[model samples]
Structure formats: structure tokens, C-alpha cells
Target: MGNNFKMIAKTLFGFEELLAKELRNLGAGNVKEGVRNVAFEGDLGFMYKANLCLRTAIKIIKPIQSFPVRNENDLYRKIYHMDWFEYLSVDTTFAIDATVKSDNFSHSLYVSQKTKDAIVDKFRDTDGKRPNVDVKHPDLRINVHIHKETCNVSLDSSGSSLHHRGYRISTNIAPINEVLAAGLLLLSGWDGQCDFLDPMCGSGTMLTEAAMIACNIPANINRKGFAFEKWTDFDEALYEKIIAASLKKTREFHHMIIGMDKAPSAIRKAQENIDNANLTDYITLKRANFFKTTKETEGPLHMVFNPPYGERLDRSDLDSDFDVEEFYANIGDTLKQEYPGTNAWFITSNLHALKFVGLRPSRKIKVFNSHLESRLVKYEMYEGSKKAKFQKS
Candidate 1:
């Protein structure tokens, strides 16, 4: 407990609760939820474990300092007064990312510039030479977040986004982000209890994530590196122990995980990615038009996917009056006729097309795919002779 420190895990919108729950399950102390972020207490090893295991977190930040500032000069002075030597040396490379919501600070770039200047000047005064800024790849990445008049300075422990799980060497046109895919699968109540399917699987991201979750595999077990690996205090032995312990917890998954895509290229890419994740034994990828396919498994099925949104992709070949609406309607029809006793969920940016799905969504969650605002909607297909209730368009 003495080694415990506060850390914040940043996530996409509507995933705060999910992240908090994950932190709690991971044995974090004093877990709390915030807007698009979660706060928790853990030691340095736990930090490494969180980065390696968390499915939803985009990045993990360790707060170094917090203060009140009304202007840019104050911000610079407070930042300069901190002992930056603890994190960076004169030979180390660093970068600053700033986010401002204060009435006095309008530009985040300007704030970052001011903070950088303060750090460099402070280092130059003491050590003769100062650390240079390396935006693309830095030894130390500093985050300055200003909310109203309060400023929080933190070190970004995850250098690049956690979505780069290192296993996806291939991708389709609109490959789903791994973090978002994993979160969506969890949100849809995927527990490895039933057969899983991603009918329109683009690059097999959902299938790989589902298999990992089902088997209790560490989310980034295949990842080549993490930002913490570059830290001065990085303990390679401790990290190896954590990795071994996590792998020991892996359980057997009885249900099948399957993926289907009409595009040969998509099927190939999905297969390659699944193999890269070392989950080829647990997942099966097929090149079949979802509309023409029926339930291959005998028991209950769980389906999650992301189809074309008609924004960047061409939906013209879907049908004569092809729009997002018509495409979504086809999805609804295919699910109803072929996949009985299934829970189907998909995400789309085109809300107008959502009405065309015909089935009323049992749950709707707001999330963002990069810059596009999207929704993760769910449809329930009951078993037996009873027909599923759907809103007629």
C-alpha cells in the first residue's frame, strides 16, 4: 500500500463506468469514475499490468503536480518550479500535450509551447544543455490539462494509444479500433458463455478481442512494447513476473468464435490478424455474404460488428435504392430470418440509417470512432416460434 499512487485511465465517451469496473476487477484501490476517464490507486507494477491488460483504456497517466493558474505566465512558472529532473535528463527527449478548458486559455498549442519553454529554460539554467522536443517519439511525454482555473500535470505512461496492440499487422478499409472493439464486445454482455460471431467482420478485430476476453488473456500480451518500458524506473523482472502471472490465469473457452465477410480481402486480413494474435485455434474466419448465411451453431449466439456507414465507403452496390437505411434494413432481415436466439449489436455513425434497421434497439450507447460521432445499438432475437418485435419503417 505504501507504493500505491494515483493514476487515471483515459477512455472514450460512455466507457467511464466500464473502465472503472475493469480497474476494480483488476484489484485497483479507491476506483472512481470521471467523464471519459477513470481514477484509481495502484503501485508501479499495477500500472504496468493496467497498461498491459486494460481493454478499454486509451492511455494511462500518472499525475505529477496540480495547481491553480489564472494565466499563461502562472502556468509556466508553476511548471518550471517543479523538479523535472526527476523524469527527464539533459540528454532525454520530451514533448508536451496540453488541453485547456479555461476562459483565460483559448489555445492548447500555445499552452503546450509555454510549458515547453518553461521546462527547457529551467533545464538550461541548471544543466547547460536542455532536453529537445521529440513530438513523434519522446522519452518523456508530459500532459498539461487545464480545467477552468485548475491545472493538472501528468506523465503519459502509455506513449502511443493502447489500441496499437501490435498483433494487427493487417487491416481493412475501416478496421475497428481494438479498444473500441473490446469495449463494445463487453458492453454487449459477451462472457464467453455462448458462440460468438461478427457477421460483417472487417479485419477480425472483434473476433480476436472476444477470444482474448473469453480466455482471460492479457489484452496486450502480443504487444511488442509499452511506454513504461522506456521509463527510468522500469523493472523488467517485475514486468516479466506480471506477464507470467497473467498468462497463468488464462482459462479454456468452450464456445466457438467465428467471423464472416463477403469481401475476400476482408476475410484474408481478418485471418492474418487472428493468426498474429495467436488465436487462430480459437477463431474461424470465413468468406461468406452475411445475408446468405444462416446460424452455423446450434446454441445461443452473440453477434457484434460494424458495417458500412455510407460516409467514406461506397454503399451503392448494396441495392438499387441503396442508402445506409437500406443496408441496415438488410442487416435486420438477415438477423431475423437466419439467427434466431441471438443478440446482435453493431455500431454506425449514420443515425438516420439506424431507423431503417427495423428492429428497435434494446440499448443505445454514444461513442466516437475517431472524429465521427457514433452509436452502438443492440437488437435481441428471441428463440422459438415467436417473431421478434421490430419497428416498421
Candidate 2:
């Protein structure tokens, strides 16, 4: 790992462990899990691979400098004194994203302004011009993080959140974030071993992510572009090699991946997204209420989905004219009576409605679906003559 440099993969809350494990599995050195982020060491190629493969990572950043700062002036002076010529030029367009958690710096925007001023001032002093600030489509996106008295500066390797997987041109009312979808599948132990189903498959995100995981495909294979592509030292040939190598590792997935939604519009949207992902062959979409359908496959089935919890999806819009509590009860009844020999999992932000399910969850994990605090609960339905016992939550 002599040629390795440290990189940070930012993730959502409760997904740090998954991202760190992914980094280690991808042959990262010195992997460490942080709050909503993971720090690891890898070379340029590995960095690219990490961006392409890390399912739970939101963004990847490369820190360039760390220093102590007493105030805004100290921050500007320290940033100005750095060798900005190595990373940026007058011809490059740049943007600064700041995060401040300190009494010294209360406003993150002000910190970003100071950091930008310092970098531009440095360029102006040496060269005759300075880089222009382009927040939307910057050639280089710099990160400024102030933690109390210390400041850390980094380059954003990922231009946007990894959730923009370049697929899913269509979405339903409440589409789940791609990273959160992938993380939920991983946490459910959905290794593509058996048939998979996302019963309330809104936009087919869970199904798409499940198929990708089953085939070991790179997470960001459909991404538009990374920030590193616009960097000064990007190696095009090495990146091409990395892409080829990652694609070559994809394995065959024989098990069926199924998605069902009652609404015809959602079904159409899901199909469009599945087609966009080029995964129409691996996944099948149907317009049917989950309560009316039974397990189609013979073997043990794996299920993961984000159902309408009455919080996002209005109850009247659903096919059934049942209230939220009644809807949850029906879900519990369906899984218990119709879908036997299946491991079902779903996330719901409606905490009160959870108790109406009546079925105890085999496992429960605390996760966040956007700003709403949610719980991903698992229920294992028994097979054959065996009886499955579960503890009530």
C-alpha cells in the first residue's frame, strides 16, 4: 500500500459499518469507521473502484490539508498558504462545500466564503487570474470541514451523491434513496441466494438494487460521472482498466427478482426504471396488490420493500380503502396466511402503526429514510411442518 492515499467515504447515519466493510472487502488499507463516514487508504485506481462499488457510500472525498484555526482570519491565512497550484488553476471552475460544528464558526456559508476567498486570493497573487466559482457544475469541488478548533480540507471525489445511479428516470410518490435501498438489502442478508421480492415496489429501487447485489455488479456502474474525472491528475487509461476489471467480476444471477405494485402507474414507472437500469431480464414487474398475491416461487423467498406508511402515501390513493392501522394489520395477515416460507422485511416511519401488524419481528434495525427516523423490521414465515416463533416488540 505504498502508493496508497487516504480517502473518506461518506454515508448516512447507521450505514458506516456497511461502508467500512465494503471498503475492506475491496482491499482498502487502514479502514476506519467514523460518524456517517468511513476513512480508508487506497490508490487512485482503488479510489475509482471504491466509488464504483461502495453501495452504501453517499460520496467519496480526499482530504488534502488539516490545520488549527482560531478564527476566520486564521482559517483564510492557513488556506491561502497551502499549495493550491497543485490542485487548482485559474482555468478551473471550483466550489466550496463547508460543514461547521464549532463555537468558533457558527455559519457554514461564511466558512465556505472565507475558504473560497483564500484559494482565489492565492491564485490571484501568483497568476494573473483566479478560478471562477461554479456551484452546480464545478470542475473541482472542495470540502471545508471545521470541527471546533480544527479544520480539514478535502476534494470531493464524487461530484454528486451516489444515490444518483443514473438509472430510475421515473419515480413514484415516495421513492427510496438508492443508497438507503442498497443498505437495507445488505442488512437483510439478501445475498441473492434465493428468489427476491419487493411487494410494494415503488419505482422498483429495492428490486434493482437487489439484482445488482446478487450479480455483484458495481453500485455506480450507471453513474453519470465522478468529480475525479475533472481533476488535474486523472488517469483515463487506469480508470478504463478499473471499469473493465469491475465489470468482468459480475456473476450470473439465476434466481427470480420480482416486484409487485397495485397501482398501474407505479407498475409502469417501475418497469421504466427496470428497463433504464438494463435489468428487465433479471427482474419482473406486476400490477397486483400484495395481499392478494401468494409466494410464486417454490424455495425460500427473500423480501425487502418500503411500504406506504400513511406518512407519505395517502391512504385514499391505495387500492384498499383501509386506514393505516388496518393496512398494517392486513400486511401482517397476508404475510402470515398467504406468503409462507418467506423472509419478509419492510421499513415504516409510522411507529404507532407498527404495533397493529400483530406479528413480531424476528429482527429490527434502526435506520433513517431521509429525515424520518425509521425501523427496518424483519419477519420470518415458517416452512413445511416447522413452526417459527417470534418475540413481540
Candidate 3:
């Protein structure tokens, strides 16, 4: 094994624990959780594996330098002193993404500019030529985060957000984010142990993520590339070995995975995405109203979906004649009456509409969908005459 180094895997809100657990399971050392991020120690190969397998991590960054800076000149001086040639070349293009949470530095753009100037000046002084900045498609992506006078500079290992799983070529209005979908699936404990269904599988993001989780497939197996591929120290043979090892660990999924949507267009788009993921054999797509369907399989069913919350007034997914309360009531009614011996989980940002679901949720987990605070609620429907478990007020 190569020398171990520290890396930070960034995640969304309410997903720190999940990312930490995932890191630990992947044999990461010195795993520690922070606000919306997890720190860990691993060799370069493990970094590749983390980007490929971790469902919740938005980006994995390798910190190159950290220092205290009270002013822009101090920041520039600290950055200029670093060995920029170790990471970037005169031919390489780069970009900076900065985040500031400090009273000392109020503008992130200025911080980014200062950092860029420092790096470029150092290169021009040493080699007489500096790498050009390409904000759109950078050969190397850098991250600068300042928190209360502390500045941390890191290299972004993932170029685009990890949510771009590459399989979702088609999408409907208000499609769920891929990371949120996978996290919700993991939270719901959908282990491919039983039959699975997504009632309102718009654009099939959730369904694709669920299928990958159930099959133990690498989340980014279909992704085009990572920023690490552009790194000077990247090892292609090592990454290939890691990919092969991960593929060897993929277990077989025996049960059926079903996705249903009322819109035929949604069904078509979902099918395209599923096919793009090459998961057609494992998932079945249907165009049917969720409220009109009943359980088709005999075994215990694991249902996870994202129903319309009437939160986005202009969303096309919302029927032209949508009724929020009545729709939620119908969802509650359908699950209670039709899906016996089942566990149904859904996320919604509409608190008012959620209240109209009639049955109290057994579990209401706090989560966020973009800027909207949301809840992932669970309802357990018992078989026969057993009472369904409901949450108490």
C-alpha cells in the first residue's frame, strides 16, 4: 500500500453519519464526521474507490495547504509560498471554487481571486509561464474554504458533483437529486431483501439509485470521469484494479424492482435512464396511477417514492388541476387500503400537505431537498387484522 493521506468527503445535510459509515465500511482509516463532511485517511487507491462507491459523497477533496490569514495579502503570501508546480503544469487549465464563512473575509470571489493570483504569480516567477484558468472545464479544480480566519486549500477529486451519476440522461420537471435519492434509500434500509417499488418514479432517479444500491453496484460505474483522472499522480492501473475488486463484491439481487408513473412521458424517460444504467433486466417500468394500483407481488414489499408535494407551483409534474390535500389523502388511503404487509417511505417539502395524509408516519426524518426543508416519512401497513403502526403525537 502507498503512504496514506487525509481526504475529506463532502456530503449534503443530514447525511454526515451515512457518509461516515460508508467510509468506515470501505476500510478508510481515522474516519471522523464533521458538519456535512467526513474526514478520513486512505491511500490514493482508496480515494478512487470512495468516489466510485460512495453514494452520499458529493465530492472528495485532498487538502494541500492550511494556514491562518487575517487579510488578502496574508492569504496571497501563504498561497504563493506553496509548491504549485507539484499539482499544476503550464499546459494544464485550472479553476477555483471558494466558500467563505468568516467575518474577516466577506467575499468568496475575492478570496478565490487572491488565491488564483498567488498561484499564477508563483508559476510565472518560477517557470515564466502560468496555467490558464478554465472555469467551465478545468483540468484541475481547486477548492478554498475559509472559516473564521482559517484558510484551507484543497484539490477537488470529483470534477462535477457526484450526483451526476451519468445514467440519468432523461429527466422530468422537479427530478430528485441523485445523492438525496440514494441517501433516502439507504435510510429506508432497502437492502434488496424483498420486492421494491417506486410509485411515482419521475424520471426514474430514485429507481436507478435503488437498483444500484440493491445490486451492490458502484454508484459511479456509469459516470464518465472524475477530476482525479487529471491529477499528476493518478495511477491508472491502480484505479482499474480498484474497479475490478469492487465489481467482484457485487452481490446478486433476486427480487423484482418496479417503477410506476401516471405520465406516459415519465415512464418513457424513466425507461431511458434505466436502460442507460443498463438496469432494464432488474427493473420493470409501468405507466399507472399509484392510487389505482395494488400490490402485485406476494412477499413483503419495500416501497420508496417521491410524491408531488404541491411545493413548486409551476412544476409540470403537478397536474394542471392538482389538489394538494386531496392527493395526500388519496396516497394515505391507497397505502393503507391496498399495500398490506408493506413499508412505504416518501419525502416531501410540503408540511401542510403532509398533515393531510391521514395516518401518522411511524418515522419522520428531517432532511432537505435543495433549499426546501423536507421530511422522509415512513408508514408500515400490517397484514391481516394487525393494526398498522402509526406515530404518536
Which candidate gets the maximum lDDT versus the true structure? 3
Q: Tell me the whole-model lDDT of each prediction, alpha carbons only.
A: 0.90, 0.91, 0.92
Candidate 1, clashing residue pairs? none
How do these models rank on lDDT, best leading? 3, 2, 1
Clashes of each: 0, 0, 0
Shift of residue 78 alpha carbon in model 3, Å: 0.7
Give a tens-digit lDDT track for model 3, residues 1-393.
Answer: 459999999999999999999999999999999999999999999999999999999999999889998999999999999988899999999999999999999999999999899999999999999999999889999999999989999999999999999999988878899999999999999888999999999899988998899999999999999999999999999999999999999989999999999889999999999999999989999999999999999979999999855464465646678788899989988988899989999999898888788887889999999988999999888887764454322
Question: After superposition on all CA atoms, how large is the RMSD of candidate 2?
Answer: 1.7
User: Per-residue lDDT tens digits of candidate 1, residues 38-78?
Assistant: 99999999999999999999999999999999998999899
The CA lDDT at 379 in model 2 is 90
After aligning candidate 2 to the native by TM-score, how far in Å is the CA of 277 from where it should be?
0.9
Instruction: Please identify which of the two predictions, 1 or 2, would achieve the higher lDDT against the true structure.
Output: 2
Better of 2 and 3 by lDDT: 3
Which stretches of candidate 2 lie above 4 Å from their native place?
313-322, 385-393
Q: What is the lDDT of residue 379 in candidate 3?
A: 88
In order, what is each prediction's RMSD in angstroms? Answer: 1.9, 1.7, 1.5
lDDT-wise, the better of 1 and 3 is 3
Per-residue alpha-carbon lDDT of model 2 for 179-237, expressed as tens digits? 99999999999998899999999789999999999999999899889999999999999
